[model samples]
Target: MKRLFLVLIPLALLAGCLEVDQHPHWVKGQYAGKKDDLPFQTHFHRDRLSWWGTISNRNQHQNEYNRANP
Candidate 1:
């Protein structure tokens, strides 16, 4: 019991520090399945049931431009 707690505690703390590196150009649509020509700034088709696309954020200058113009 003591050994298990020691191991689990450190692992839990390390897990909190880990950040997942998901790319910006990956968007999962909300319409059941995939669709072509999403209004996102840039996009990629993922399989056939989803699309990977770019989203505009405070730091994404180009994405902001697309949103403003589109």
Candidate 2:
């Protein structure tokens, strides 16, 4: 039991140094992804009001209070 403790104690202490640096390479305000567009720009043809109404109605349907009342 004493030998097991001596081996495990040092092994556990040195295990943390094996980790590689995982920080992102881009931190200087330059995006490295593809260009994106608004959700409603293509589907709803840039109709913000219609897109907002759809989102609001979907949220209402998912509400617990609205479901219990109905």
Candidate 3:
């Protein structure tokens, strides 16, 4: 049991050190609008206000006044 644990522990630690790419290959500039585009440009657009709109919409859902009184 002790020998098994000693070998497994080192293998587990080495596994964490391995580099892994979580994103799909197409995300690495293989698809349209991915290459030559600033990251999060759509989310931070001035006219659309995508990020702000999402936050405000979420807040509205959480607001007590917006919910039906129990």
Model 2 regions more than 4 Å off: 27-51, 64-70
lDDT of 2 by residue, 1-70 (tens): 9999999999999999999997555657875665687998878999999999999999999999988955
Clashing pairs in 3: none
User: How much is the lDDT of residue 46 in candidate 2?
Assistant: 92
Off by over 4 Å in 3: 1-48
Clashes of 3: 0
Model 3 Cα lDDT, one tens digit per residue, 5-48? 99999899998787987765565566534455443465576444
* Greater-lDDT candidate between 2 and 3: 2
Write the residue-wise lDDT of candidate 1 on 1-70 in tens digits. Answer: 9999999998999986779876444447444445556433244433333332223234465565666955
Top model by TM-score, which number? 2
Lowest lDDT block of 10, candidate 3: 31-40
Give candidates' CA RMSD values in order. Answer: 14.6, 4.0, 7.9
Of 1 and 2, which scores higher on lDDT?
2
Going through the candidates in the order shown, the clash numbers are 1, 0, 0
All candidates: TM-score = 0.29, 0.51, 0.31
Model 1, stretches more than 4 Å misplaced?
21-36, 39-70
